[model samples]
Target: MAQSTRRRFLLAGAAAAGALVVGWGALPPRQRLNTAVPLALDGGAVALNGWVALAADNTVTVVVPRAEMGQGVHTALPMLVAEELDMPLARVRIAAAPPDKIYANIAAIRDALPFHPDDTGNTQAFARWTLAKVARELGISLTGGSTSVKDAWLPMREAGAAARGMLVAAAARAWGVAPDGIRTADGELFHDASGRRATYGSFAAAAASENPGDAILKEPHAFRLIGRAVPRRDARTRVDGTARFGIDARPEGMVYAALRMAPALGATIAGTNAAGVLRLPGVLSVIDISNAFSWRLAGHDGAPAGVAVVARTFWQAKTAAEAHAIRWDAGPHAELSSDGIHDDLRAALDGTEHHVYFAQGDVADAQAHGRTIDAEYSAPFLAHAAMEPVNCTAQVADGKVRLWLSTQAPSIAIGIAAAVAGVDREQVELHEHLLGGGFGRRLEGDMVAQAVAIARECRGLPVQMIWTREQDLRHDAYRPAAVARLAATLDAAGTIKSWDFIGAGGALTDHFLRRNLGLPGAGPDKTTVEGAYDMQYAIPHQRIAHAAVASAVPLGNWRSVGHSFNAFFKESFIDEVAHAAGKDPVAFRRAMLLGHPRHVAVLDAAVRAAGTPPAGRAHGVALHHSFGAIVAQVAEVSVHDGAIRVHRVVCAIDCGLAVNPGHVAQQMESAVAFGLTAALEGAITVAGGAVQQSNFGDYPVLRMGQVPHVDTVIVLSGEPPEGVGEPGVPPVAPAVANAVFRLTGQRLRSLPLRLA
Candidate 1:
């Protein structure tokens, strides 16, 4: 087809979509909001609910509900299913799951409810149940919080095991033998007594009808694939460029889009001059993607007001966008700067209102009896800065909408797109692609909504919008800048008598709702004080509280979220108290963790792995438990001419039954690289309600030369598997800071530890 003819075809499709939207607006309001339904599978394959699908060719396909962003989840989850079926990883195929309640992430939501990890009271139980109910009903399918494996651990295994049992039962019926006498191996059912063997493919029809008793999952000792270092399913495809990432989604008659948004957070477009931009090469149309009415109702940040320039290619769109002129409303937040944010948080620490998440004996009485040591700490806001800049593809035609993107929360994305496009939720179809990298940024539905909003203007055309790196960095739901005040009372013998911790920051409640569901919620957010309040150290008289301050900075989950910086504040303060009382930091922490053997074990392993830093090098130690995993990190550092160089990090983790020990070690290494970058140079400052840094030039990651050698030790345990992706992140920054303090004698309480 010629270019002109193709353009006309796309224009006609766009017009059809526009007409559908107009028709949709005439329908009753009740019709626009439809209840979400479960998955209805297509194709000739046998659909076993939502997590497993089988073909007659003995191709066992396990449906993964998690997004693969280079964390090895694509392989880790497959192990759970393949292990139960007693099949090699090579024999099974992996597929993306449809958005359904059967795939909802039930664990993370339960963990998010406001309660200490140790809480078991009625209030806690009630909150947990309420959260669980909401998750199950809404089908809250997401892939973050290091929960993919844990959530899939039991269910995936059972699904596969049950299918395996049915195959054996079918073979037994056909061969006139007891089901117990039929053994299955490598996708085949066999009976040794009768010397009868048949491929699982031959029994597929009967197996689907056979009733297998309750699936008894394999024990650890009998496991063939769960614990081994199996290669990732996506490894070969990734290396050979065969993997289809979000950026690779190219729809027919697709036109590219490049966006220029309001520079300030929570700002809107006042006007634009698009005449000259349209004259540029390949520029198709200039469309205003910002929906002021819906943006206000959605209450989501990082959906900054923007104008999109659709063109023949991304480069054409991007080049034309750079020249487009626009006036932005900086709004009431024009004066909100980073320095002011910190000062306000610091001041709020002294305010009367504080919600304590954890408490023990009377902290006031303990402080009155013992000598107290106090310290203040702060951390700058951080950006997700994922490798793939925010992008989405959408096609709206004939009263229906289609979306293809790399997203963590597809259920939320489906609703967000349909609502934004003025279509019914049931009319939306979402095709999830592999994420280039998420790091918690993709958890929000902003990009999905933004794309649909733009696509609606395309008449019935298919549009793919790819944000520039600057656009991505400048408009992100940042990690909230925080301030912390910590105090410890020491007895005569240098024993810790009391602990008081007050953390003040931008609240996570509103952002949690917006990012999770494009809605709003009330009550205290557990994420606000997650790392600060949930430490397992056995301080006798302790009080941990969070002071919610006011800030309009767009805040969302970054890497470890609260733990990303709170670990620096809490663990570094503990080191200060240890030093103030003339005690060794490691031994001081050891004394406090008497009953916590799991925590103690990781700490001891980290210490042994690190041994001792030489006289020229200083060591810092930190232990943190998160996502039901305990990680201990020891950093060896040397400071010379006021520059700190981290030489090595010895990390020990007990994530319970390491699914793949090699992958666990790899994740730890990745986390150290991620955390060290933040510890050394990560910061996102706001000035005049706009972000200060735009790209890697200013907000740099740890380069290869700067990255330290990470020695990883995975502790074997009997408990169920926990999170490996995020648990390793919390302890790294503090370990580096403690090491710096030991070397320089300057207690660095703040993040991106600077020396004087």
Candidate 2:
């Protein structure tokens, strides 16, 4: 059976079984407004559901459930509420929401369903609906996948609307007038007939008594604060250095700890000189925590075991930890190398077994007649390389665990911490801080778990564990390396008649589910073949497959997940097919996107904005759709002394309606710089089962001078808002690679696109 058909059948079977237990599974999501504990109100603050709090001073606070990782989510999420409540954006304050089922990332999971963006058939729609309900029940509160804005679009607005209606109703009751007669603007409710005006704060007590029944959201045209660019709410704090990142956490009695992990991916300590390490100045004790977490027992992989030195200061702890001598058991993977992993992927591709992700029409028959073009592309494993190294602070007292850290998934972090601390989830208190960078590094709970284990030996004192930059990179859950073989056939008319893309790599989703949820990952993973299978191009005969190869390397989601590398594969191959057919790259893509107006619009916008490349530079274009957003990028490139330099990148995005156009543009620019770093120099190599590149010297990032001047054009869209954070990243590498091909006539099929 075709993959799509098989997926539908499985979903149907699961839905049938779920309905028997979950009462038909068609119920709406669980209530998002009510919390077990009410919002901690003070100074005449009125709690309105789980999201909004109104104070007697007429201040509005919107609870942002997502992390503020420089994406301006602290500002953009509040805009959703301010627009509905008729409040000025500048007057709104932001608060991080406590971990709850209400803040679960239903959109992320629903978006992860193995269906093409254009596949809106009944089966896919039903599967999405069912998955969303299940996601709500699971309540995995996460803040990755560019899901913040898209997930909050409806709920936050409704919270504001409900509060607005309640305030209006409260005023109507006070004045003996109909609720419909009250108008709200700038935090004031007005009644023209009676000439009565009052602040929403004045009616806070009464509004709490009034019921807002099915409050209506404002139409797009009625939006006041949304669709307008406002300064980020946390900008001032960040600028003045008042913003507290995880590293900035300083508790009253906190000590410092430095970890010296095993020198290999799955190694453990055999022996250590604890007494000598403890003799170092300011060194409190050496705690051997190698047995704290068992990857096999936890169904996890590549969680490094280590010994930590607790001391008076971070530097002292680091000095002591590094000086300690230890013998390690490197295990079976001691001889693993990057070359070995590459060969493993190639061997997997040679196998006959594969999971077909998407298939349409008869690709074999179509491929038999047309002119064919085949290419193989590979991208090396990459580290998240977040600016902040891994660190976490934890304290265990009175059978309770308290943590201070930056995490992408608080619910998951809490769960991991609870387990490590041997406490119940509710007994754990997580204080989330701002992240210096999370591209996806903070998503894993390993850091939190390790910190909790270290703190357990601190005798009721809080311990802040910090990893050196070398340790951070070496022990990172690297992005999975992937290899793809793509073959496409063009008809006599220079139009693609058949397209096939088969990829092989470690399946990140399986690894993630096993490590995080302990759920067995069966069936085809959408992430393994996402960017290739979900292409918006209208290929009549197409097949996309993926063969998962087992690996000991710790894998995690990167900036764009599968789209990160797959776009480089699919789009670059598309460029090859275009050239082979003697057609312009943009024209070739445009021809395939006739049925996709949003894609065509973005491509046209990017092309128009890019215009003609300056002398000595060539422009290359690529388009990709991910996270319900379509982004097209045109890169201007020049090779100077055999070094590829991206001069400028013009990006156009149709991310539904951008919640904040300015922030959207900033994200595009950030994504381009990040993607360029990977395209030009990012790679995480392994030797003897350990990461070979430890710090920036071996693993370099894109320098400021190397960053291209990015121009973003957001196509005016009326569709519901989608994500902007990751959508811009997918097309960047391919765009640059294609531009280099255009300039140098060299097809760089491998990543870090070295010029030969």
Candidate 3:
């Protein structure tokens, strides 16, 4: 059977099974009919399924449900699948799987839950409830939150083991030997006593018939590929310029499109001279794309209202768009500026009543007795700035649509395209392409809709809608800027008595509800409140609250999400507390993290790895926990020429078990570059509702000459691997900032620290 048909069969079977279990005579006849239906997978298989097909030529294809955007999921995830299947890594070929609920990420569900491990109910019961609700709402469980590897850690491995089990069973049946007697190694099943052996490819078809067995997964001790350094499977293709990104995809008779969105958010086209633009060479059509905000709330200025230019080539469309004379009616936020936004957020925080996400003991009472220290820190708005600018290719014909794009949320992309094109979800197909980099921008489906619109306008001819670098940077959903106020009380012994954190920022929770979770009007988003509430300190009294301030600028998840700002806030405050107490910064953090061994382990490892710096070198340490992983970084710095020069950085991460040491190291290196860019020169400032910086000239990335030699230490706790991509980001900023503070005796509260 074809892949699509097989996938549908599996989904239908899984849905029926899930419905029987969920509805089980508990509801009335009418209620049972109205209950939410579960999404089914193809091939009549359920419960976290994947397949490995070995062709006669020894080419092994492993299907994955996650998106690959430089996170190395394409490499790391397949390593698990291949190892469990007992196949050589060199023979494995990776394919992105179809969208299905079976692949929905369980970690995002856990993130949405209100119940903590210390909550009243049984932890397992809470987990079950959280996951079921997530499955019902998300429709398709998939990527986001750097949970791809952790979520797939078990299921993908199990699928491989089960496939191996089936192959062994088939081999045993063919050789007329006991299944237990069959031994496998290097893709070959052998029975030394009987002198019978067969390659997996020879038995793949026969293996498809046998019932898959539930073999226990290999322990860490038995792992051959899990902990070892393995080169990325797609590295050769990527480096050789053979891997196709969204911009590289070109269907037959495909045309290109360039769009000029309204300079002001929520503005509409008052008038346009389409008649003049239609005469331009290579210009096929000028489309007035509608602004839809049903999925997300309209910002202060509103949706990205605009016009699109479709042409024979991207440059043609771009040229035509530039030449087109269009007038825009600026919306309500015409006068909005970055300084005005700062004032508005500060005003919001001044409110007496705030939404409290987490509180322990009485912060007000503790604040009254001891000496108190207070400070405010702020971070500027940030853009995703992915290497490959936003682009999506679509072929829409007779109510059938297909999308080729690099998207983190393929299920949502398909659903949005289907809805916009007025077609059944089945008719809308999504082909996952290699993303140059996502950061989080690819999660939005607007580009998918734009491509579909251009395709529909071209009479079913495929259209590859591409955004210019300027358009991509200006029209991006930005990382929200934030302002935080931290107040703490210290006793005479220099111990923290009370901690109160109040922050004001754009609504991350609101965005998550609209974009990913598909929930509307979910109050007081928890993402903005997470890092503050979940601080890994042994404080006697603590309270964390957040207030949301509406802004004209678009805001969404960046690399580390809220933790990026919160780590800067929390860690900087901790350093402040240490300074007030005249204690060593590392010792101060170590004292507060008395109960959390993993946090201490990373801190200890980073410090010891850093060792004693030379006389001129100053050391700074920071520890942060995010995505279920704890990381600590130590930076050694020397100041010269009014610049903070970092000589070396020592990073230690304890993410349970290191799946692939090489991949982990690469992620750390990438994370350092990502975070350093943000720390040194990353900022998206708006003046009069327009992004001020364009391209790398103003918004700079870290250059090779400025980057210090980084040393990484992965501490193995034998715990389950949590996350590697984003956890590495949170610590670097604070570590570097703290090092700067040590060198100059100046407390730098804000990011992109400037030395004067």
Candidate 4:
């Protein structure tokens, strides 16, 4: 009788689980066409949907939901709306979308799932589908992962088409003509049969009442503004010094604040000379901001404790804060050092069994039958080092909080600010500004919370909190330092038979989810093993794994995240394997890429563009696929004065249907410069549980004189647009390292290649 009851319970549980899956899958997709709050309209404009507005002057305004961080997202996204709306790019203006879940970055979160890009199994598909729905409901508005274009591609176009349909229908009703007969072009509706023409503005008000039918999107051939090299919308403002970054935001009667966190990571303030600081010129108040918000993680608090000095002016605040004496009770990780962290990473390789991210075929059998090659590579923790230091302006008054800041994730920022200000989420009003540079740093909402925490003590006065460059670098949630062990077997035919890679690092995704979402991250993280496991090279037997080493140090996303360093590890190892098999690097890569025509095409384009290097320089090639795009780079390099000199770079990308070809080329140049900095000079060392590099004087970027001449070739394709911002970064380090090997006859296995 007990067995029968148990069996009945088991069957009931299975039936309920099956029913839940079916019901969840059958749910409709979240609406992306409306917001809880109406869009702000000017000049008697009418919002057609969540993404578009039409004015009485025939002006079209596109709602750009993503942050503008010099990535050309403002220009690129508007081009999508302008193309589908048949409006001239110049006439279309862009406005920041209000806080809304419709604009959430679903792609970025979906990409965070553990499924490999190459995995097309039913389980992977179901998991992705489920996660996407959940992410939509959760509504994480973010701008990292190069997902701005990819996420907005369909939605923006559909929004434009739907708006146009409404306008056409309005015009058709006004003229008593069929909506199909009324043709739209250049922001005007024309009835060719009756020779009647009307501006879109004439029907803008009436169109608000029309029922917008299913939008018929234009084909690729019909695009006019999307593929063209339109001028960046923010360029003129930035050039004319009219563009307002977070630091430039000046609310009326706003005071300034200077923040100083604990010297050690996650440490707390024990005491401060608060009376002395208040006596300084223009000093208003010194607030204790330790544990300002409940930024909790499992076994750790993600929030850093600090103190803020609020004063009449920024310089006054800065001076007072600098002179204010303080003492800290060092955190639990006081013994932490860069060397110790690296030792832990290396030890993890032997002491712990890593979670396998990807595996196929029998790697053990293939390795046992073939000649083996092994190598290890590592990358140090890196800071974003954006030109503009972290800053946020906040005011707490009338039971509400107002914020003016540059943040990559405003939805997250609003909630954090509300909590810090002791208000509801709906009471927070955010005014997003242009970012001088983001690179992924602004994704964290700590600055917003810190600003609100300081503002709460200002008695309703606005306060602009700014972290000096030293504070910015020292307190950054850094790119996790990683160490990778790679092994492969070469067959008698000089071809790779099997490849295996194991990387150890603080799990970036796990840390990100914990810090941002307050959720415990478990299972294998794809970010830890992406570039190694997701490579396009068709090796038969392969395995990719990650050993997540927990540390007290805070970790966050950098420019390309894992792909930035993993490509260096994976591609440099491939180059080494090619050398061991006595084959040219480019030829070996091509031989391995038999099944991936897209990768092969991009590689060939880069090689063709590179042609032959000048005298005293040698060419080295690297191909990497990331963020749904494939990029290949060929570096023309030579060694001089014990330094690796990369004279030129030829890059090719399959970014798929460029929204703005000129902007795409610009990103490649930007990535090369950024990646070159990391490969040549970037390092963040820690000692006594504190970051050693404080400012650009020590943590320098690549100088303009040292920047390589970059030539970009776009691989024309009909595929949908993928990421254009970060994919170019992954290949640069490996390409330069490989070139150094050929030019100097020495394998520089590590970053910041120094010759002995």
Per-residue lDDT of candidate 3, residues 1-756 (tens digit): 111211133335546767555754343322100113332333332221344556655567777778888878888888888888788888877767756555666666665553322335464463455355545445564567878888778777877888788889989898888999998887889998889888887886787678875656888888888898887878898989999988899788988888878876556789888998889999999988754334444332223677788999888899998898989887677888888998988888898656776667888888888999999998888998899999999999977998988998888788778766878888987878888999888877778767776677779988888887777888888888899999999998989988989999988656644553355544566667656777878888877788888756776778888888899889888988889988898898889888788789899998999999899888888898888888898888888887777788888988888888887878888887788889778888887778888788888887899887788899988888888888888877788888888888888888778875
Q: Please provide, for model 1 over 192-275, each residue's C-alpha lDDT reduced to its tens digit, 9 standing for 90 to 100.
A: 998999877677777777765688888899998888987777889989999998889988888898998888877788888999
Please write out the lDDT profile of model 4 over residues 1-756, one tens digit for every residue: 011111133335546778666877689888777677778898899988889899989999889999999989988998888888888877788888787899989999877765555557776676677778877888889899999999999999999998999999999899999988988889999999999999888889999888877889999998877888888888899999999898888889999999878888867788777989999999999998876756555554455787899999999999988888998999787989999999999999887668776677788999999999999999999999999999999999999999999999999889888877888999999999999899999998778878898999999999999998998998888988999989999999989989988899988767776676667875556677778777778888888877889977788889999999999999999999999999988899998888888889999999999999889999989999999899999999988788788899999999999889999999999999999999999999999989999899999999999999999999999999999999999999999999988988788777766776
**Any idea how many clashes model 2 has?**
0
TM-score of 3: 0.91
The TM-scores, one per candidate, come to 0.93, 0.98, 0.91, 0.96
- Candidate 1, lDDT over the whole model: 0.82
Q: Which parts of model 1 are misplaced by more than 4 Å? A: 1-44, 120-130, 292-302
Instruction: In model 3, state the lDDT of residue 678.
Output: 90
- Segments of candidate 2 deviating more than 4 angstroms: 1-6, 12-22, 295-299
Q: How well does candidate 2 score on lDDT at residue 179? A: 88
Candidate 4 overall lDDT versus native: 0.87
Task: Write down the worst ten-residue block by lDDT for model 4.
Answer: 1-10
lDDT of 2 at 94: 80
Better of 1 and 2 by TM-score: 2
Best by TM-score: 2
